[model samples]
Target: MKIVKVEEFDLRREVEYGSAEQNEAVRTIVSDVKKEGDAALLRYTEKFDGVCLEPAGLRVTQEELQAAYSQVEPSFVEAISAAAANIRAFHLRQKRNSWMDLQPDGSLLGQIIRPLKRVGVYVPGGKAAYPSSVLMNVIPAQVAGVPEIVMVTPPATGGKAGIDPYILVAAAEAGVHEIYRVGGAQAVAALAYGTDTIEPVDKICGPGNIYVALAKREVYGVVDIDSIAGPSEIAVLADDSADPAYVAADLLSQAEHDEMASAILVTPSEAFAKACQAEVERQLAELPRRDIARASIRDYGAVILVDSVEAGIGVINKLAPEHFELIVEEPMAYLGLIENAGAIFLGPYSSEPVGDYFAGPNHIIPTNGTARFSSPVDVDDFIKKSSLIYYSKEALLQNGATIVELARREGLEGHARAIEIRLLKEGKAGTNNDNQ
Candidate 1:
C-alpha cells in the first residue's frame, strides 16, 4: 500500500464496474433472454455455467430442499438459523401498513402501501455460496409481505451439478421456496422478461460480478433493481489514540474481497499511519486470499495523512465508501459529520464484519460512490406506495373554482372543463379565481 499526505494525494480513483465490451455482452444476453425466453435461458445457462437442463429441471424440487438438510452439518444449520433470525427480526420493524386520513369534509386522503406481489432475489453461486446474501435479500421482501419470492443462482456451485446445499438451506430457512438453477445476465433477463418456466418478477435484488451488475442495469426499467453495485470497499478514519492492529485488520477484510476492492486509511498522526501500514503488511502476509488482497492493497489501497480527524471526514464524504470505520475517540460526536457511506461503524469494537453477518441491518449496501445517492436494501425496496385522494361532493364544490382556474392557466381545457362542470352544477362557478 502506498502512503501519501492527504493534502497532496489525488482523491480521484476510478471505479471499474466493467468495460464497454462487458456491458454489450450483458446487453446481448438480456436481449436473447427477452426474445427467446426459456430456450435462450437454457442456452446461456449451458454456455456460461456449463450446466444444461430442461425447462422442467430449471426449478429446484422439493426433494432437493429436503436432501440439502442431510448434507450440511448440524452446527452449520444452527449458525445459519441464528443469522436468519437476526435478519428477520430487524426487517420486521420496517413493515408498513396501508393507512388513511379522514378530513372534516368527509374526504379521505392517505397513502396505500402495498407489498410487491412477486420478487426475485439473485444469489451468487457456482464455486461461491452466499447464504448471507440469500438472507439479506429475501428477509426484507418477506417482511414487506411479498406473497411470492423467486430465487435464482448459478447452475453449478463449486463445479458441482446442483446448487450448494448451504445456499439451499439458507433460502429455505428464509421462507424462499422457489429456487432456480440459472445465473448471470440471462437469469436477470429471465426475471425481468419472464419465460414459460420462470415468471417475471416485480424487482431483482442482490450482488454479483460486473456481468450481474450490468445485467441489472440493462433490465432496470423492465424490472426494478436494488442498485448497480460496484466492488466492495472500506475506509478507516482513525486518530492517534486508535489501535493500529484493529484498523489494519479491518482494512484487510475488505481488501480480500476482490482485486478491485479498496481499503484506505486516513489518520491525523503520521506515526499512527506508519504503524497501521506495517500492521497491514504483517496481516496481509498471513491471509489465505493474499494474492487477491495483495493486488487490491497494491493497486487501490492507500494510507492518507490528514491534518485532523475532522478534515479526514471531508475526504470520507467525497469517497462515499461502502463501509466507513471511525476508530477515533468520541466517534459518535463525528457521526453527524459523515454525510455519505452505506454504513458507519463507530469505535474499535464495532467491526465491519459484525454488520455484514450477525447484525440485523442488511449487508447489501450501496457501493463505489453510489452511497452518496443510493441506500442499503431494506423493506422499502419490496413495497410500492400510491397516493389516495377521495373528493366528496362538498369538497369538490368548495375547491372546484381554484382547480378550474389553475387548469385554465395551464391551458388544459379538458381539465378546466372537468372542474367547470362540477362548479356549475354546485352553483359555485361565480367565485373569484384566486380565492376559489
Candidate 2:
C-alpha cells in the first residue's frame, strides 16, 4: 500500500469488467441456451467447467445431498445451522404483509406484497466454495415465502468434477433442495431462459467472478438480478486513535478477494497513515493469497492524508465503497457523515468479516461505487409489489373531471376516453364533451 495526499491520489480504476469478445461470447451462450435449450446448456457446461453431464444428471439428487452430510466436518454443519438461524431471524424482520386501507368514500387502496413464485440463487464454486453465501442468498428467499428456490453452482470444485459437499450441506440446511451442477454464463442463461431440465426463475441473486457478473448484467431484463457487481472494495476512515495493525488486517481482508479488489484508508494523521502502510506490507507477506493481495494493494490500495475527519467523510462519500470502517474516536458521532456505503463497520471491534460470515446481515452487497444508489440483498429482493387502487362511485365522480382534464392536456384521447366512458356511465360527465 502507498501513502499519499488525498487530493493527489487516484482511487478509481479504469478497468472494464468484460471485454467485447467476452460479451459476444456470453451473448452467444445466452442466445444458444435460449434457442437450443438443454443442448446448449450441456455443451457450455462441458466447455467451461470441463464437466460433461446429461439432461437428467444436471440436478443434484436427494441421495447426493444426504451423502454430502457424511463428507464434511460436524463443526461445519453446526456453524451453518447457527448462521442460518441468525440469517433467518434477520430477514424475517424484513418480511412485509399485504395491507389495505379503506377510504372515507368506501374505496380501498393497498399494496399487494406477494413473494415471487420462484427464484434462482447462483453460488460460486470455482475460485472458492462459499457455503456462507448459500446461507446469505437462500435464507432471505425462504423467509420471503418464495415457493421454489433453485440453486446453481459450478460443476467442478478445485479442478475436480464433483460438487463441493459444503455447498450442498449449506443449501440443504437453508431449505433449498433444487440444486443444479452448472455455473458461469451458462448457469445465468439456463436460469434466465430455462432449459428442458431447469425451470425459469423470476429473479436471480448472489455474486460470482467477472464472467458471472457480466452474465448477470446480460440477463438482467430477462430475469431480475441483485446488482451488476464490480470488483470488491473497502474504505477505512481512521484517526490517530485507530490501531495500525487492526486497520492493516481489515484492509487486507478485502484485498485477498481478487487482484482488482481495492482496500483504501483515509486519516487526518499522517503518522497514523505511515504506520498503517508499514503494517500492511508486514501483514501482506503473511497472507496465503499474498500474490493476489500484493497486486491488489500495490495497484489499487492507498492511505490518504486528509486535514480532518470532516474532509475524510467527503472522500469516503466520493468513493461510496462496498465496505466502510470507521476506526476513529466517537465513530457513532460521525455516522451521519457517511451517506454512501454498502455496509458500515463502526469502531475496531466491528470488523468487516464479522458481517461477512457469522453476522446475520447479507454479505452480498453492492460493489464498487454502486452503494450510492443500491443496497444489500434483503427480503424485498425476493418479492414483487403491485399497487392496488379502487374507487367508489362517489370518489370517481369527484375526481373524474380532473383526471379527464389532465389526460386531454397530454393529447392522449384514448386515455381520456377510457376514463370518460366510466364517467359517462356514472352520469358524472353530463355537460362535458370536451374530448369530442
List per-candidate RMSD values in Å: 2.2, 1.5
Candidate 1 worst ten-residue window by lDDT: 427-436
Give the Å shift of residue 413 in candidate 2. 2.0
Give me the candidate number with maximum TM-score.
2
TM-score of decoy 2: 0.97
Q: Could you estimate the TM-score for every candidate? A: 0.96, 0.97
lDDT of 2 by residue, 1-436 (tens): 7889987987565658788898888888888999999999888888888787889999999999999999999999999999899888888999999999999999999999999999999999976899999999898888999999999999883335579999999999988899999998889989999988999999988888878888889899989999877778999999999999999999999999898999999999999999999999999888999999999999899989999999999999989899999999999999988999999999989999999988799999987788889999999999999999998988888888888888888888787888889988877773255656
lDDT of 1 by residue, 268-302 (tens): 99999899989999999899999999999999899
Candidate 2 regions with alpha-carbon error over 4 angstroms: 157-160, 430-436
Candidate 2 lDDT at 418 equals 86
Regions of model 1 farther than 4 Å from truth:
157-160, 430-436
Could you tell me the lDDT of residue 405 within candidate 2?
Answer: 83
